[model samples]
Target: MNVLVLYATVEGQTRKIAEHVAARIEGQGHMVVLGDVRDPGFAVPGTFEAIVLCAPIHMGRYPEAFVRFVTDWKTAIEAVPNALVSISLAIHSDNAEERAEAEAYPIHLQHKSGYHPASVHHAAGALKFLEYDFFKRFLMRRIAGKEGGPVDTSRDYEFTDWAALDQFIDAFAGQIAQP
Candidate 1:
C-alpha cells in the first residue's frame, strides 16, 4: 500500500518516532512518505492508499499549525484508510491521573475537530535535556522528577514503545487488505 506518514514535532522526538514507523512500514513491502505538516508546501499525493498523522503534545496542546493542517485536509485524509497518534509525556506516566489526562487530550482534539480517524494511538514521548535550553531543561527535569523519571539535565530520555506502534501499523495494514 502507499502510505503517507506526516507529523510535527516540538523537540524532535515525535519526528524520530514517525521515521521509525515509516521504516517499519517500508520494511513490510509498502511504499511510504514522511513529511512535516508545518511545511506549507507539503506535496501529498491524492492516490495514497492510507495515511497516518502524528504530532507531539507541547504545553498540554498540539501545535496550532498541525491542527490547522489536519482540519484543512480532513476530507482528504478521511477518504482513505487513516490513523492518528498523539505523543506525550502523559502516555509515559505511571500515575493514573497523568495517564487519564494524556488519554483525554487526543479525544478532545478528535471531538473538537470532528476528524474521526480509523485508529488512534497514544505513545509516550521523550525528554531530551541535551537538546533544550536552561529553562526548558530545568522544567523538563522537574516534570520528570515528579514522574519518577530521570531528573538529570545532562542526558536524554525516550519512552516510545516500538512493539505497540508496530502492532498498530500491522492492524492498519490488515484493514487495508480486507476486501
Candidate 2:
C-alpha cells in the first residue's frame, strides 16, 4: 500500500507526530510519503491507497492552510481510506470540557471542509515553552497552570502516547489490507 502522511503544524509537534506515523507505516511494509500542507510540492490525491492528515490545534482552531487543503481536495481524500490525527494540548487537559472541545475540533473541520475522515485520532500535543516567544510563553504557562499541566516553562512537555499511536497505525494498515 502507498500511504501519504501530510500535516500542518504550529509549534512543530504535529510534524513530528506525522513523521512518526510515516515511519511506523513504512515499518509495516507500506510505501509512505510525508509532506507538509504548507509546501507547494506535496503529493496529490489519486496516487495513494491510504492517507493520513495531521494538524495541531491553536487558539481553538486548525491552521488555515490545512483547512484549505482539505476543502480543495475533499473529493480525492474521501475516495480513499483516510484518517485524521488532531493534535491539541486540550487533549492532555484534566478538565473534561477541554478534552471535549479538543475532540470537537475535527467535527468543525469536517463541517467547514466537507471532508470526513474514516478514522479520527485525538492525540495530546506538546508545550514547547522553550520555542515560544515571551508573550506566548506567558499565555501558555497560564493555560497549563489552569489545566494542571506542567507549568515549568524551562523546557518542553510532551504528552503523546506512542503505544496508542502505534496501535492506530496498525489498525489502519490492517484496514487497507482488507478487500
Candidate 3:
C-alpha cells in the first residue's frame, strides 16, 4: 500500500501524529509520504492508495485551510481508503460530554466537506503552554483548569495515547495491505 499522510496543525501536535502515522505505514512495508497541507506543493489525494488526514480542533472546529483542502479534494480523497485523525484536548477529558464533543467533530467536518472517511481516530493533543502567546496561554490555562487538565504554563503536557494510536495504525495497515 502506498499511503499519504496529510495534516494541518495549529499547535504542531497534529504534525507529530501524522509523522508517526507515516512511519508506521512505512514500517508495514508500504510507501508513505508525509505532507503538511499548508505547503503549496502538497500532493493531491488521488495519487495515494490510502490516506490519513490529521487535523486539530481549535475552538471546536478544524483549521479553515484544512477544511477547504478536503472540500476541494473530496472526490479524489474519497476514492481511496481514507482515515481521519482528529486531535484535540477534549478527547482526553474525564467528562463524558466533553469526550462526545470531541468525537462529534469529525461528523461536522464530514458534513461540511462531504468527505466521508473510511475510519476515524480521535487523538488527545497536548497543551503547548510554552509555545503559546500570552493570551493563548491564559485561555488554555482557564480551559484546562475548568476541565481538571494540566494548568502548568511553564512547560508542555502531552495527553496522546501512543499504544492506542499504534493499534489503529496496525489495523489500518492490515486492511490496506489486503489483496
What tens-digit string does per-residue lDDT give for candidate 2 at 32-59? Answer: 9999988938576778899999999989
Q: For candidate 3, lDDT tens digit of each residue in 1-179?
A: 77889999988899999999998889888988889888838566878888889999999999999999999998988898889999999999999999999999999998999988889999999999999999999999999999998888899999999889999989988888552
| Candidate 2, RMSD to the unseen true structure | 1.4
Q: What's the CA error at residue 89 for candidate 3, in Å?
A: 0.6
Model 2 global lDDT (CA atoms, 0 to 1): 0.90
Global lDDT of each candidate:
0.84, 0.90, 0.90
In angstroms, the error of model 2 at 69 is: 0.3
TM-scores, all candidates, are: 0.93, 0.97, 0.97
**Candidate 1 residue 99 C-alpha distance from true site, Å:** 0.5
